[model samples]
Target: MLFYRAALPLSRKTLTFVAGIIRRHRASIGSCWRKLNPGQQALLVLAHLRKGETLAELAAGFGVGVTTAWRYVNETVALLAARAPKLRRAVRDAKKAGYAYVVVDGTLIPIDRVAADRPFYSGKHKKHGMNLQVIASPGGDILWVSGALPGSVHDKKAEWIWGVLAELEAAGLVTLADKGYLGSTYAKIPYRGKNKPESQKQANKAHAKLRAPAERANAQLKNWRILRKLRCCPWRAGQLAKAIHVLQIREA
Candidate 1:
């Protein structure tokens, strides 16, 4: 009843990560995602985010239509979100097993007018609408992802650190983030004991150092042409994150 499991040549890191996830959220994965073909589901999800594919493009690529492609993307995203508790637990376990020190940030995806009209964003992109806010580990594994918000919405305005920190706290892990997340309240240990200006500067320095790995991780993600382009809708972005995470874990 394995809904999704990686194929052979599984890297030690990937096998460990998957095993941890399965151990932590055995119930949810079995209950919800058991019906779907893990390979097709993973491919379909990745196709949406991969560069050079519109809904129409995806339809043609998968030999379907725009409508059907959209349906699959939505359904898959909904399924993942529904099983968020399990995913969260998996991420928590990974952190506990020395994968702590997460990198938190957000990205935007552009959408056309028809999709733009939906409530996905509070505000719209200049011409294309956007899906905002994704928090991932250094290996590109998503810790938590927020609902699609307006492109105009600033990362700071979203205040995702609190929730992300809470999850980390519950998991007993520490966090590392960029300046965008400064002043954010989460499961963080702030640096102390420097003079006023120096203290602030030192905090910034520390954050930068801690965030270095995640920055590199994001760069690696961008190296994948798929993530470079905003082909998928917001929902598909989550799926894309999952696929990338899987790939990263395997490579690791």
Candidate 2:
């Protein structure tokens, strides 16, 4: 089973990081006898998350039953997410760093449409998925990620629901967002008025230039292919997103 990891192409840094996390996870949980060591289990879960491998394939490759493989992956995801920072803390950090502003944006993560519920249907993207709000520094470092919301929720609504705007407001941290978050007092959004003056259009363009890094940050999150199209339970979307977020921070 360990040989399977060698066969699959992965970077040395990622392999080492996964092994370290697995070692720490095992140490925290105390001694336990299992078919695969912590490193192998970590590799198995990382392959599933980073490679988007299915349970059946992971089970065969890791020499574990499908049920065990699923448990291992979910448990590891939860573990990583537990260490993710809350929105308020992230906002405070930004203020302490003397950042003039942070960027906020909402991204849609495609998921398996297991049901016909309209909530998962995003009219904007015309797809079934969940919305995740992300905040990043001007340099494209992700500062925080909000929990999953129904795809049908508007970007502004999602920001309010996640208390992102409120936190920034309380921390006196300005934020740069797109027109999607038009009404936020703490966020500097592009002018959306119709028939705007040349000055307004120019401001919008400059606003766009500043907000470009947020879009790049969102793209970086989606680079974790498991987030490309989630096939697991929708309730776990937040956990998976947070796990990927923490891993990306480590990469930085």
Off by over 4 Å in 1: 1-45, 55-91, 112-131, 138-141, 160-162, 170-172, 186-203, 216-252
Residue pairs with backbone overlap in model 1: none
Q: Highest TM-score among the candidates is held by which one?
A: 2
Best by lDDT: 2
Predicted candidate 2 versus true structure: per-residue lDDT over 1-252, tens digit per residue: 344334444566766776777778878888587777777887888878787888899889878899989888877788889889888788888899998689999999998895577989999999989999999998888899889988999999999988888888888777888888877777888887699999999998988888886678888887778899988877678889898888777776
Where's the lowest-lDDT run of ten residues in candidate 2? 1-10
Q: Count the backbone clashes (under 3 Å) in each candidate.
A: 0, 0
Write the residue-wise lDDT of candidate 1 on 89-185 in tens digits. 6555666658757766656555544544655443423444444455566655555545555555656665452355566557766666555555667
Q: What is the lDDT of residue 193 in candidate 1?
A: 49
TM-score of each: 0.55, 0.91
What is the lDDT for 190 in model 1? 47
Question: In model 2, how large is the Cα lDDT of residue 129?
Answer: 92
